[model samples]
Target: MAALISTTDTEAQSSGDPSSKRGGWITFPFLMATLLGLSITSFGWVMNLIVFLIEEYNIKNIAAAQISNIVNGCFSMLPVVTAILADSFFGNIPVISASAFISFLGIFLLTLITSFDYLRPKPCETGSILCQSPSKLQLGILYAALALVTTGTAGTRVTLASAGANQYEKPKDKGSFFNWYFLTVNTGAIISATAIVYTQDNASWKLGFGICAAANLISFFVFISGKRYYKHDKPMKSPFTSLVRVVVAATVKRKAVISSKEEDYHHNELIEEAMPSKSFRFLNRAALKVEGDLKLSGDDSFNNIWRLCSVQEVEDFKAVLRLIPLWLAIMLVSTPIVVQASMMILQGLVTDRGLGPHFKVPAGSLQVITIISACIVIIINNWLVYPMYQKLTNKPLTPLQKVGIGQVFTILSMAISAVVESKRLKTVGNEHPMSVLWLFPPLVIVGIGEAFQLPANTELFYGEFPESLRNTATSLTSVVIGISFYLSTALIDVIQRTTAWLPDDINHGRVDNVYWVLVIGGVLNLGYFLVCCWLYKYRNLKNDDQEQDP
Candidate 1:
C-alpha cells in the first residue's frame, strides 16, 4: 500500500503533466512553521537537559553532563542514517512527518515523567552524602523517551533542510534558501535558548516540557497540513549499492586489459557518453563493456547488474573517494567546537548568571550568544564579506577557503576561552560568582567561525556530490557534529581519569588547562586542514572555469 502511494507520487511528478504540481515557494510557510516548532521543542529540552537530569532525576553533575553529551551525540549522528533511509526508501516528506509524530510522543512521555513521581528517582536532599539511583523501570522509561526524541529530531533536522532546498531548481535560489534556512534555524535556537530555557529554569519543568510537547505535536500537524503543496522526491534504491557494485566490478576486472577508447565504456543511449577520468583509473574498468555485459534491450535478466555500471557511476564513486580526506579534515575542525560547547555549559553553571537584581539568566540560555552571533555573522558574510573579498581579490572565497578561515577563528576562540578560563580560576574563591558575561566573547568567536564554515561545508557537499547522493551529502555535516559530540564525551572522560582538569566541582579543577589543550589540538587540526585544502583539486572545475572565464 505504501509503495503504491510512493509510486503514484513519483509517476505523477515524473510525467510533467502541467496539472502536476511539483514545487514552489508556497511550501515555505509550512516548512518554516514545522522547523520553528520542532526547533523550539527539541532545543528547549536539550539545552536544559543537564539541569533537568541533575535537579529532577537526582543525577550528579558529571553524570548528567555525560548523559547530555551521549544524547546529543545520538541526536547529531542519527541523521546520517535517517537521511540515507529517506533518500533510499521513504522519501523526505514521510520520514519528516513520521519523525515529527515520534518526537511529539517522546516529548509527551517526558512531560508525564516530569509530572509523575514514580517515573523518576527520589530527589536528593541538599548536602546529602548518599543518593538513591533510579530503578530500572524509571531508567527504562527515561531512555525510551530520549531514544524516541533523538530518532525523531535526527530524521527531521537535516532532512528538512535538504527538502527545503529541493523546492528550488536554481543554484542561487538554493543558496538563498540555505541562508534563510540557517537563519530560521538560529532564530528557533535563540528562542529556545532564551525563552524556553528561561521558562524551564524559572518555572516548573512540567510547564516547559508540556510546551515542548504541544509545540512538537503542532509541528507534526502543520507539516501534514501542507501535504498538497510539498514537492516530493521519489525514493530510489540506495546509491551506495551502485557504488559497491562499481568497486566489486573493478576488482573482478583488475587483470583485464585497459582501454582508452570512449566506446569501450558502457553507455546507455539515453545518457551522454564520456570516458572516465584518469584519477582512480582502476575503477574505470567497471564501466568497460566486457562481452555479454550489455544485455539486449527489454531483457529482464539481472545478470548484468553487478558486472557492469555506467561511466557516471564509476565517476561518482571516484568523487566520493576524493572527498574522504576533505571530510576527515573538516571532522578535525569540528571536534574542538563540540568540546567547547559542552564545557561552556559547565562554565555557565558555575559562573554568576544574573543579569541584574530583578532576574537571572539560565546557564543554558548563555548559548544564545553563539546562536545570535552565528545568525548575524551569516548575514554579514552573505551580504558584505563575499562581495568585498571578490572586489579586492578579483575572486570570491571558495568553500574550502572559507572553512580554512573559519579554522583560524576557531583557534582564536579557543585561545580566548583558555585566557578567560584562567582568569575565572584566579577569582574562583571570591564572594561573588564570576560574571557569565565573560563567557560571551569566546562563544561569539566560535559562532562567527561556524557562520563561515557550516554553511560553506554544506554548500560544498551539496554542490559537489553526485545528484543521487545529495541528501546523504547534506547529512555529512550532521555526521561530523555527531562524531564530535561523542569525541567530546570521550575527551572529558579521559581528562577526568588521567588528569585533574574535569573534577565534578570544576572550581578546583584546572579547566583552563583543558581549553589550552583544545587550543593546541585546534592548532594542529588547522595545519592538517590546510594540507588537505592545498591538496584538494575541485572536481567541479566547470564552475571554477566559468568564474575565471569572465
Candidate 2:
C-alpha cells in the first residue's frame, strides 16, 4: 500500500499531459532560483566583507561580525514557520516568488544603508555625502534586511528546489534532475561569487551590488513566465494539517527505518555501533510512547488509520525521530563549508598575505574560489570520480557515503589553510606580497567537499523524507546550513576577541590573523565531520520499507 501510494504520487506528477507545458513551468522556477542566488548571495558576500574591513571601521572587534550569526540563526529557526506556510498557503511558487522579492528589497535597503553612514565615513561615507555610523536606525535596517534575505534564501531557495524536483517524471529522473539542479546552482553561484567579486574588487560597490539586483529581477521574470507547466501540488494549509502531516509522514519513515534496522540486524552490519548517546536513545524511547498515544487518540478519519496503522504507525514515527540527530551531525560538518564565503574568507583577508602593497584581497571574492572549485569538481566527480570508483570497486558510493567523502575533504581543506597561515606568519612585516595563489589549494579542497556534500545532501533529504514532509525536509536541510553559518560567525567573534597573542597591528588588519582563526574552525570542522561519517555509516533506512506503492 505504501509503495502504491509512492508510485501513484510520482505518476501523478510525471504523467505530463501533451497539451500542457511540462518543461516550461520547471524552467521558470529554476530561473527564479538562479536570480535569487545571484542577488541575495551577492549581498551576503558583500555584508560579510564589510565586517572584515575592520580597518575601515577603526573600532576594535565591532560585534558587527555577530550580526551574521544572529541573522543566520534567526533564519534557520524561522524555516519551521515557512515550511508550515509552504505546506499550507504559499505553495512552492508563491513562497519562492515572495521570498525572492522580500530578499531583493532587503538587499536594496542594505545597500542604501551601507552606502550612507551617519556616524562613520570611510566605509559608509562618500566624500561630501556623509554616511551615518552604526546608528540605531542604520543598525536596525542592516539586521532587518539580513533577516529578509535569509528568509528569501532559506524559505524560497530550499523549497523551490524541492518543489521543482517534483516536476520531473520518474523517481530515477528526479534523482538525476536534482543532481543536475544542484550542479547548476553551484555553477551559477560560482559565476556570481567570482565575477561579482571581481566587479566589487575593481569596480564600484554600487555597480557590483546593482548588477546583482538586476540579475535577481531577471531571474524572477524567467520564473514567472513559464510557471504554467508545473504540477501544482496543493500545499497543506492548516497548522494542524501541517503538524499532522509531519507526524504521519515521520511515523511512516520510522517504520521503514525499523525495517532497515531489522535487515541490518541480520547482516551484522555496524548499525548498532552507530548509536548517539544513551540520552538520545532514552529520548527516542520516551518519544515513542508519546507518539503511540497520539496516534491512538488523535483524529483519524483516514482509511489507513482505520486499518494497519495501529501497529506500524508507532515504529514509523520512531524512525523519523531517530534521524534528526544524525542530520544535525552531518550539518555540523557542512556548516564550515557554507561559511567559507563569510567567516573563513574574511579571516583570509586580514591574516593571509595581501595581494600587493596595501592591496589585500577582497573578502567577498574569496567565496569565488569555493564556488568555482565546486563547479569544476562536480563536473569531474560526475564524469570521472564516480565512474572510476564504480569501475574500480564494482559498487559505487551512495549519497551518505559521498557526503562522508566530502566531510573528509572539508577537514583537509582547513588543514591546508592552517599550513598557509603558518607560511603567512613567517613572512609577516616583510612588505612582500604573499601569493593569493596559496589561498587556492585550500579553496579547491573546500570545493571538492562542497561538490560532494551539497548534491548528496539534496538527495539524502528527498530520499529519506516522507512524501508529505518533503518540503519540511528540504527546509530542515537549509536550516542546518543556516545554523552552521551562525556558529561559524560566532566562533570568529570569540577568537578575534579572546586571542591574547593577536598583535595590535594584525587586529587592525596589519598582521592578517584571519587565516589562523579559520584554521581553528577547520580543525573543529574536521572533528565533527568524523562523527558525521560514523553516524551516517550507522543510519539504516531502507527503500522498500519507506517507499509507498503507486
For candidate 2, give the lDDT of residue 75. 62
Per lDDT, the best of the predicted structures is: 1
lDDT string for model 2 (346-422, tens) is: 45555543655666566656666777788788889989999999899776667767776787788777666667756
- Candidate 1 residue-pair clash tally: 0
| TM-scores of the models, in the order given | 0.92, 0.71
Highest TM-score against the true fold, candidate: 1
Q: After superposition, how far is residue 90 of candidate 1 from its true place, in Å?
A: 1.9
lDDT, each prediction: 0.85, 0.57
Worst 10 residues of 1 by lDDT: 541-550
Tens digits of per-residue lDDT for model 1, 1-550:
6456456656777787544445668788899899999999889899999888878887877778889989998998899998888888999999999999999989999999999999998888789857788998999999999999888988898889888888877889877887677767777788889888888889888899898999899889999987866788778899799899999989888877879999888775777868889999899999987876645657564448688888988988988988888888888778888778777888988898888898887988877888888878988997998999989987778888888888899989999999999999888889987899999999999999999999889878977788878878888888888887788888888988899788778888888898899889888887877777766777675555323211
Per-residue lDDT of 467 in model 1: 82
